[model samples]
Target: MTMQASEKTPRQKRGIAKTVAFVVILMTVFVAGFFYKILQPRVMNAVELRANGAIVFDNPRIIEAFELSDHRGEAFTLENFKGKWSLVFFGFTHCPDICPITLAKLAQVYPKLESDIAKQTQVIMVSVDPARDTQEKLAAYVPYFHQDFIGVSGDFLQTMQLTQNLNVAFRKVVQGDDYTVDHSGNIVVINPNGHYHAFIKPPFELARLLTVYQSMVQSF
Candidate 1:
């Protein structure tokens, strides 16, 4: 017999092609799944959406004009807040519980920001009790919490220019030859454009704060 030919018919040829195609598709799917598993945690683990105390503004409110003094007695203004992100708190230096504790919490979270974000970020404590929170006093108080942190105070109207627009409230309470300030503990977030961006209400949780902060910055 002249070498009986072993040629696949149309049906046989089609069957072989189908088997090869199936194997190739399975391999492609397996490789894609493997990569997805490897990358999912790194890409998805971070807080990509706003959560915790974060309140994102659809339209960032334009900051009102004001002049204030920083800890070193330098001029601080809405213009100064431009070109960076600011986390501003309104409290007196003598606040018994909230002021120092909140600043300390901020200090903890401040360093955790990505370097790019950190470079564009600032922490400011605006003394509602400007009577006692002189620039010198602020100098001593603010840097004690974080060396880079700023303390600012001004005349009532100047301060009000900021606090009123931001909706931070305060009042003086006197008791037994001493006084304390009753003020809003919420922190205001100012965007790089020096606009009111959001509010963070206390009591703060650091991890949650960081997540929301990072998400906000990244999105912006």
Candidate 2:
């Protein structure tokens, strides 16, 4: 009977050890998957960093080319904007709130530009949702912000290519068979040579942006 009990003790120990090993493996897999799900978007964002600096335009992507048209029936290429500073914003005219707010603040900064500086600084608005923001609508909307502001758009293929090159992430969200574009809320500044100038991320401080604009204009 003592020998039988000894054999039973080994069997019980082996069963308990196997159970603990299985639980550990399950927990490790669960934790690894949880971490992956939490960090995926951040990893993708790291791959899309654009220019960042206080005075100069930080490193901007120069890898892609775009062909688009302006609101007033003029052909606007990346080439046409050469030799002037452009405050290029990406949004549709149909954007009811945020777009107008940004433009209004930009308007506040507009007249402050000195004449020589003003001529060099062109306010440009590019629509990420081109299917809806037509030339006429854009023409009307742009002037409400600043009389001289220019609005531009193109077909989906061309728009996507340009936005991607600029590192602007946008998605067309579909619901009940209709769709709306979910896009980033930031402005890109293109320099006189048609290279990137800088970017202004929002919650914008009007005083700071105006100051930055003045400095950049002086540099140009």
Candidate 3:
């Protein structure tokens, strides 16, 4: 009987320890879940921003001074990007598919934006094929989609200055003595401070783009 009681006491201590461990683990999960619920709105907002193609940067990149000419022959410099938000696309007039489609979708999206946002925002298309896409060509091409949309182009070096800083990639491809400019289709967003803020990935959906853009501007 003495031996049996000693064994039972050990078993009881083991049982108590197991209960204490289970209680600690259960409380840890419960505390974690309570904090998660409290933070859900901010967490979900960030997730929704990414899901909608609004890839915001943790730190905005500063844009250096670069010189290019706008469709109106005005000096389009880094200063042009200040004082308002700019949506910039890199493509050429000869882009047979993506450029035109993206510009058309932007045209549709622009007018539907809230009045305050539309007033403060500007749309710009920078030519990747400066050798073939002249100011006259851009002037005629860019405004066809939207009158307010600005087209920018310059010498190869000047174009490179902006494209390199923005991380926009482009190259000239030759086919049968003619050439085409292959370029990225992502739309770059510049904040009012002339800093690189975010980018929207291509195959852009009009509704999603509008929603995401509005959310970014409002949040800023």
TM-score of 2: 0.70
Which has the higher TM-score value, candidate number 2 or candidate number 3? 3
lDDT of 1 by residue, 27-140 (tens): 999999999888532221223333465667789898788899999989998888899999999988888899999999999999988788899999999999988999889999
**Top TM-score hit:** 3
lDDT of 2 at 207: 62
Per-residue lDDT value at 141 in model 1: 96
Which runs of model 1 end up more than 4 angstroms from their true locations? 1-51
Q: Residues 44-144, candidate 2, lDDT per residue (tens digit)?
A: 12112222224254465463567899999888887866888888788887676778888888898888766677877888888988999889989899888
Which run of 10 residues does model 1 get worst, by summed lDDT? 40-49
Which lDDT tens digits does candidate 3 get at residues 135-180? Answer: 8999999999999999999999989989988999999999998999
Whole-model lDDT per candidate: 0.85, 0.75, 0.90
Q: Candidate 2, which ten residues in sequence have the lowest lDDT sum?
A: 43-52
- Winner on lDDT (2 vs 3): 3
Per model, how many backbone clashes are there? 0, 0, 0
How far in Å is the alpha carbon of 32 misplaced in model 2?
Answer: 68
lDDT of 1: 0.85
* RMSD to true structure for each model, in Å: 6.3, 19.0, 12.1
